[model samples]
Target chain A: MKITFPHLGNVYFAAKALFDELGIEYVVPPLSNKEALEIGTLYSPEEICLPFKIMIGNYIKSIENGADTIIITGSCGPCRFGEYCELQMNILKKLNKNVDFIVMDVPSDIGIKEIFNRVGKISSNSSKSKKEKIKALVKALKIINMIDEIEADAHYIAGYEKNSGDSKRLLNKCKRDAINSKSADEMINILSEYKRKINFIEIDKERKPLKIAIIGEIYTIIEPFSNLYIEDKLMDYGVSSKRTLSPSWWVKNTALSPLKINSLDIKKASKRYLSLCIGGHARECVGEAVIAKNEGFDGAIQIFPMGCMPEIVSKAILPTVSKDLNIPIMSLIVDEMTGEAGYITRIEAFIDLLERRRKSVLFRS
Target chain B: MYYLGVDVGSVSTDIVLLDKSLNVVEELYLKTKGRPIQVIQESFKILKSKYDDKQITASGVTGSGRNIASFLIGADAVKNEITAHAVAALNIDKEVSTIIEIGGQDSKIIILRDGIVIDFAMNTVCAAGTGSFLDRQAERLEIPIEEFGDYALRAKSTVRIAGRCAVFAESDMIHKQQLGYKQEDIIKGLCEALVRNYLNNVAKGKEIIQKVFFQGGVAANKGMKAAFENALGFEVCVPAHYNMMGAIGAAILASEAVKKDEGTKFRGFNIAQSNIIASSFECDGCPNRCEVIKLEENGIIIGCFGDRCGKHSGKIAV
Candidate 1:
């Protein structure tokens, strides 16, 4: 069976490594673009969120490229995202596109046996032995962790690099080279090599660059295309940025969440503001802003799609957070019509304000 | 020694010259009419007749067309309209607690306390309460845009017009006219509807404290200002330079930037005579197909942007 999945930032790299090692045929749909969004919008319900439309577009593109089976994770939720799989399947069926779906829902909801059965469908396609399959899974996890580490390091070091653009160049080159690697092992090796190079890249110890934290809805924050590559822009401006969410982080959080042991610090930090999960990542967004302020970030930027219900709550609460903490926070709600010039101007102005606040002692203690 | 600020928006291009002491030396407001470059050049020509280019220490650009403005004339500081509006309001009154700014294409609410912007929200993918909507209604009514506000203020009674969307509002206005409502009442109804739209959509949940300053091109409409005052049950003050606040704020930012950097990237006034061209093409490097834009001066590429991957932004020759 040929399998396909939607793009979510660096998760595609891990999927490539996993399928390749398992010796199963899979198709990685093209990275989301305007064409995909247009196609998705044409077929999707009018009120559906941006990520759903983008995912539907990815599925259609993958189906055209010979993918007959679609694998997606499932969420039972108070948010609209939980309803996407059913709606997407109906739309695709109505369009007469033949495809099978494998939804990996949580064991608590679908039961452990059902998960095993679903996962077994894919593993059964592989000719590898049980021990070998486990090894492949471990290797895939290692690859994702390594890549996330390399990316985090590169982003933080971009601000202090002795040679301007050194970190950005290396980070971009690393992604390009990994995508071009002929084998899963080669991709892991390339990522590790880049990780080593980034760690050793020359950085100025005396330079103090403005640092910011990116916090928001998971899909918009992690996906570069969705938020207009904000982290990349921050890197270009020689500003250090930090984000706690990544593919690897999501995996760990999801796995340990049922045990009530996941992201304990985030839960503790968010207690005063939002003690209960109100659906989606609203709590995480608020917690991250508070954490960022404590960590001495000059400011935080909260980005989410337009009309996102959960994020709208966070957006309202963030002003109180900003006022109480005495930190500046900017909320950018983006849609297809978001003008690039206005978005960039806001970011530049925020950076300028941060710089001025640091230099002008009157504004600070 | 003066700092120049230019706000190139969809409907209007505003320019402000500020002396070293932050006093407005000159202000020019011109219709953009879909030709930002020409309007900006026209304003510069008028300014050139009064002051020398060498006397301008630094310049900044703001508003929707800021990127194009920065490319055409080297800007030392470029900011967003929200920040610019807040700065200008604070400069005018340090006690100002809230700023309601509605421009040509967008409207925003800036919440400030102790002269710092704490929270803000701009209309999302909607332009129901902006100047463009008012301009369109004015055109349909066969009334001059400047006199539209006067007609609203002269109304004896009000009519309700749906203001959720521009199309709905227009059809509702036509329905009111069909019902034989007076022109003055309908205009006043539009103003009230627009204000209600702004309060519900843009300033939905914020606590709009006292000392609110209304600034933007739309602030010229005394009717809208009065509608805001009526809805909020508090006095609303419009700045003297209401339409030019963005430019004034940009000039203030430019002054501060020049002091900090001790340099200006201002291209001489001769830039109006230079042959500069801008164009865009989709890059096929990846699936994103980012539409990369290039600015050419004398047939040589000076700036390339809009690529999310920076594949083209990095390739530009400095």
Candidate 2:
């Protein structure tokens, strides 16, 4: 059976590598874009969040491409995202699309046996032995971690690269080459080579570029298309940017969160502002902003889709954080109607303010 | 030398000229009326007739139509309305702690501490407490927009008007009028309602400190200013050039941005005669289908933007 899943930043690379290793036929739906949003909005409920609509569009596109089995991860948070899977399934059923869903909830929530059963549906298709199957999973995990590392390196080093756009060019070329690789091993090898190459790129040591932390909704922060490729824009401005949320980070955080041992520092940092998981990544967003200030970041930009309930709460709380930390924070609320020019103008103004603040005599260190 | 600043809003286009020390030397306010380009050119023509183009060292654009205006005038610095307002307010009063800027289409509250922006909030996806709403209500009441504030000031007592939305406010006003309320009372009630909406939404959770400054097109309404003061229990100072503050701030920023050696990018007054064509086309290269906007100067493409992927924007220099 041809399987498919919605895009989530670099998670597609890991999924592709795993499917390729397992010899499972799968369709990776095209990247989320205006067409997907239009289709999704047309079919979705008026008040539902942006990510839900985008995912629905991805499903329909994959279904049209002959994907009969859909794999989706599940969550039980207070955020509306947890409810998306059920609603999406109903929508597909109503549309008369013939597809089977394999939802992989946390083992604790769905039970270990059920988790294995869902995973086994796909692994069962592979003729490889148990050892090879385990190795393939390991390889996929390694690839995701490496890719995230490479991305973080490239984003940070873009500011200090001796040659302008060197890091950006390398990052783009690496992704393109990896995606074109025929085999999983080749893809992994390509990523590792690029990962090593990123470390060797010549970087200027004397440059004092602005360092900013990106904090907000996980989906909007990770997905370049959602945030209008803000990180790339920051790179172009010769500004160092760092985001704590990544596909690999999500995996690790989810795994260790049930044990009450995940992201202790973020939890501690956010305790003063938001102690509880107010559903979604509001706590993380707040925690990251505070941590960013302490880490010597010049400023932070918080981006979330318009009308995101959890992020709205975070937006209200961010002003207090900005005041207490004495760090400039700008919250950009984006929707389908968001004008690109206005959005860029705000970013440029924020950068201009940061530069002036840095050079001002009053705030000298 | 002079620095020019242009503030292009939905309802008005304001242009200001500032000397090297940033003193406002000349200013013009005109109705935008859905035509930013023509209004800007008209303002430039008036300025060119009075001042020498060679003396204008640099130019900046701000407000909603900043991008289009910047492209049209070749502004050295392009800024958002928020920053421009805050800068202009601080310039007026170094100790200004709060700025309530209610413009044609949007409203914003800037909270400052020690001459720096500490926190701020703007009205979200609503136009209930802005100048356009007042203009519409004035037209419906057959009152000239300029005299609407005077009518509110003449009221002895106010009648309740829902200010949460323009629709509800209009219906409430009509309902009050039917209940035998005077037009003056209804106008006053509307002003109070708009202020209530602004305080609850835009200025919610913000500390209303002393030395508050109110600047924007809506600041011209003494009734609204009185409503703000009455609500906050503090005096709100409306700058002399309240409506032109954005333009003044843009000029200040431009003066700071351009160095003597670097020179200015101002396209010159002759650009007013050039045929600037703006058009958009959807790029089918990807699923994004980004509707890229292109601006041509006398048939040659000068600027292209709006592509999420820099496919088209990268090719165009500006």
Candidate 3:
């Protein structure tokens, strides 16, 4: 039996660990790529949204690589994520790919005992008694948490610092090694020591310097091509970026996301703006930018899916924010036609202009 | 140091010429109605009267209809509306945290953090809160589009009307009108209901914070603005070029792209006003029913793209 989770900035490490710990045979697809987008784009239907395309890409890549089964967290929600597993799995089958997907739709109203039950359904390990299964699940959960924390930090640090840092590098290596660890203590130890180093570091400026902040719809931000492997390309140009949203945020916000209710403030905001009846992320983006600038970051690169209304609002509001804060801003909208070259060139210039501005600020100060 | 940006969308084509620094030097708002090519030519003709094409250093294009605009005018940069809108927002106020934009066919929310887009959402299926919807309702009532907001503001009482979708919104507005509710009151109610439907459906699960600015053609409506303010419990700002923000954003992106590319793609002002041929064909590629649009200038295949798949994705020289 094998198991896998979707790749965020880093969940591959845990997949390796769970398979090894259970003594279960498994395989993970290579990191996502341009071809992944091409394949996914060809397969996915329009109107489903962007993240769906990328996730479909990841699954297609994995199943095509001979994986027998896939595991995805299940949810029921207002965010439309609850339906992803069923829809993506069906799409894969429609594409005539054969693979078993163990979709564990975690009941929002339930607890982690369900996790053990879901685990038990697959493993003969159920013979080991309930306590044993609980212990294993708990341990697995801890490792998952550690991997998530590391990934979250890596993304955040990458946001302020530059491309692949000591933290991100060490986290990747440590995550791999920890995944291969023989015991929970081993994974914990590696995770612990790694956390010890994530905080004490800074980017090597003389090495190279292009920095950007990636903030937008969760669909485009994490996916490689939905927005193009923008982070990778930026790194190719020696640019480091801070991407604020991640699947980790999805996991983190899982509990709080639904409870975020419509309030008087939303109504008031609607009146204040376009009396725009719906689509709300524009304001959150503004708050996020102020927060980034306060953190002493250089500039920001914004990305969003085409025809995404909430994001359009953010795009409209950001220019003023850039001016008042003295930060350079680049907003990229991704539809099918957003050629990578055109997007990347914009990034290079934005970075160039920002660097010049930073240098001048330094000289003046 | 004048720079220009053009936003050619499904319903309208807007243009903005900015200084090198992206300040608006000239602006054009023309109804695409149905003829994008003709309107663009007319826009150029108008701009030519005021500012010589020589003074324009760069230009950019954005929106759903931008492909033809870019191909026709040799745009230095071609960007989606999201990027253009975000850039325009940042250029105006670096502290702006949110942007709310509603056009004829759609509405969007873009969230910015320190001039970066941190979050965004868009409403595509519904037209209840969009400009075209309002335009239809305005016409049905025999009220001028420009006076819709003022009429809405005069309402002392609002009769609740359904605005969940275009069909419902229209019928409900008419029903209320038939019931003899004051025109002003019905208009106010229509704006409020549309605002409510938008917040309930489009902004459903997102966190909408502060420092919001309203843009797009629909923003010209004062009653809608009031409704938005009432809904969010906050003041919403409308930029000077609210109607042309998308175009301005395109212009900003164009200027930045030109600086990066060392040249402009704009085919020069004279050619922007030339003849163009456009058509579409169905691709039997798979069962997705993708329709690929083909555009040509004279006889040259300028560009092609659409919703379906690779059927006509490969351009065949005819």
Candidate 4:
């Protein structure tokens, strides 16, 4: 079986490592771009969210590349994401593209045995021994964690880099080197070397840069193409930005959720605002905003797709959060029709607000 | 010597010339009519007839078409309308605390505290609460846009109209017209409805403190001014150069940038006669198919942009 999956930021890198080490055939669809969006928009229902449309594009592109199996994670939450698989399957079937789907749901929802059965569907295609397959999984996990750490460090150091664009240049190079590695071990080595290089980059501690936290829908915030590469723009503007939601964070949260030990800080921070899991990481978005203020961030930006129910609730609560915490938060809604000019204007104005606020506060002191 | 500012907006292109004392010496507001380059070139020709290009020290461009306008004129400073508007307002009145700027295709609320902008919000993906919608409605009613505001002032009692969407607002107006409401009352209701929509959407959750300066092309509408007063329960100050504030701000910013940079990048007013051609083509390098814009002057490529990968865009120097 040639496995295929939708793009979600850096998850594909780990997926590549896992499938490579497993000796299993897989097709990695080209990076999300205009073509994928056009194909997705052509087939998706008019009112569905942005992520669903992009995922459909990924599936079709993979199908074109001779892939016969699709592996996707399933969720049974209050959010519309839970119903994505069923609707997508029907859409693909109507298009006459017959492909097998292996959904890996959480153990709590589908039971551990069912989870393994789904996993075995893909592993059965690989001739590797059970121990070797487990090693591959472990290596993939390490790769994700390392890459996330390296990315986080680069973002934070961007504001303080003595030489402008140093961190960004290094980070881009690291990704290029990591993705080009022939094996998982080579990728890990490249990641670690870049991580050290990023840490050692000359930084100007005296330079006070505007710091922002990115919080919102998982798909919009994690996927760069979906949000028009806001993080890249921030880096270019010499702003330090952080986001608590990432593939590694999602993996850790899922694994430790049943034990009631996952994201304790976020849970506590968000308790006063959103205590319940309304699904689709709305609670995490709220929590991250509160934490951003406590962590001395200058401001926060929340991004979500248009008509996102959970984020709409979070959007309503964010102004209160901004007022209560005395932190500035700007929410940007994106869809297929989002204009770049308007988006850039908002971001620039937000940054100007933050910069002027710092000056006025410093003047008072 | 004078400083020049140009605001190339979606609906109109505004140009301003400020003397050494920072007072506006001349200003021109011309409809863009879907041709920004021609409008800019025409404005430059007019300015050239009056003053020598060497008399201008620096130039700046703003609004949605700032990038292209800046490149076309060799602007020293290229700034967004928000910053340009804020700078212009703050320059005009230090005590101004709120700015309600409604322009063509975009409306924004900028909240300032202590002469510094603290917060701002712009209308999202919708032109319902903008000058363009009002212009369209005025056109549909066969009333001169400048006189539409006066018609609103002539109304005896306001009628209720939905202003959430432009299409709905137009249909509601038609429905109200069919029901025998006076033309002035329907217009007055539209003015009020647009004010309500602007407050609830663009300026949502914003604290509108007094010394509120109303600016932009829509500021010319007396009915909008009255509606804003009725909604906010305070006097709204409209600057003398309300329609050209973005351009004025651009000029002020360009002057400031010139002081630091010690030289202007302006190509001179003679550029109006230059053989400049702007065109675009679909890049076939990848699946992105980015429509790369290429600018040529007398058959020599001057600049290229709009490519995501920078493969085509990097070929030309700014």
User: Per-residue lDDT for B1-318 in model 1, tens only?
Assistant: 999999998789999998888788899999999878778777877777788889989898888888778878788877888778888899889999999999998888888878777667777677898999999999998999999999999999999989999999999999989989999999999999999999998897788998999999999998998899999999999989999999999888887777777688888787666677778999988787888888888898777777776677773111
Off by over 4 Å in 1: A206-208, A356-365, B48-51, B204-207, B260-263, B315-318
Highest TM-score model number: 4
Clashes within 3 Å, all models in order: 0, 0, 80, 0
The candidate 1 chain B region of ten consecutive residues with least summed lDDT is B309-318
DockQ of 1: 0.39
Q: What digit string (tens of lDDT, one per residue) describes model 1 on residues A279-316?
A: 88998999999999999998999988877888989998
Top-scoring candidate (DockQ): 4
DockQ, per model, reads 0.39, 0.33, 0.02, 0.41
Candidate 3 residue-wise lDDT at A279: 41
Model 3 interface DockQ: 0.02
Error of 2 at A177 (Å): 2.6
Ten residues in sequence with the least summed lDDT for candidate 3 chain A: A356-365
- Alpha-carbon deviation at B246 in model 1, angstroms: 1.7
Among all windows of 10 consecutive residues in model 1 chain A, the one with the lowest summed lDDT is: A356-365
Residue A311, candidate 4: Cα error in Å is: 1.3
Say what the interface RMSD of candidate 3 is: 14.1
- Residue-wise lDDT of candidate 4 within A102-198, one digit each (tens)? 8878999999999889888888988999999999999999999999999888889888988877887888788878988988988999998998898
Docking class of 4: acceptable
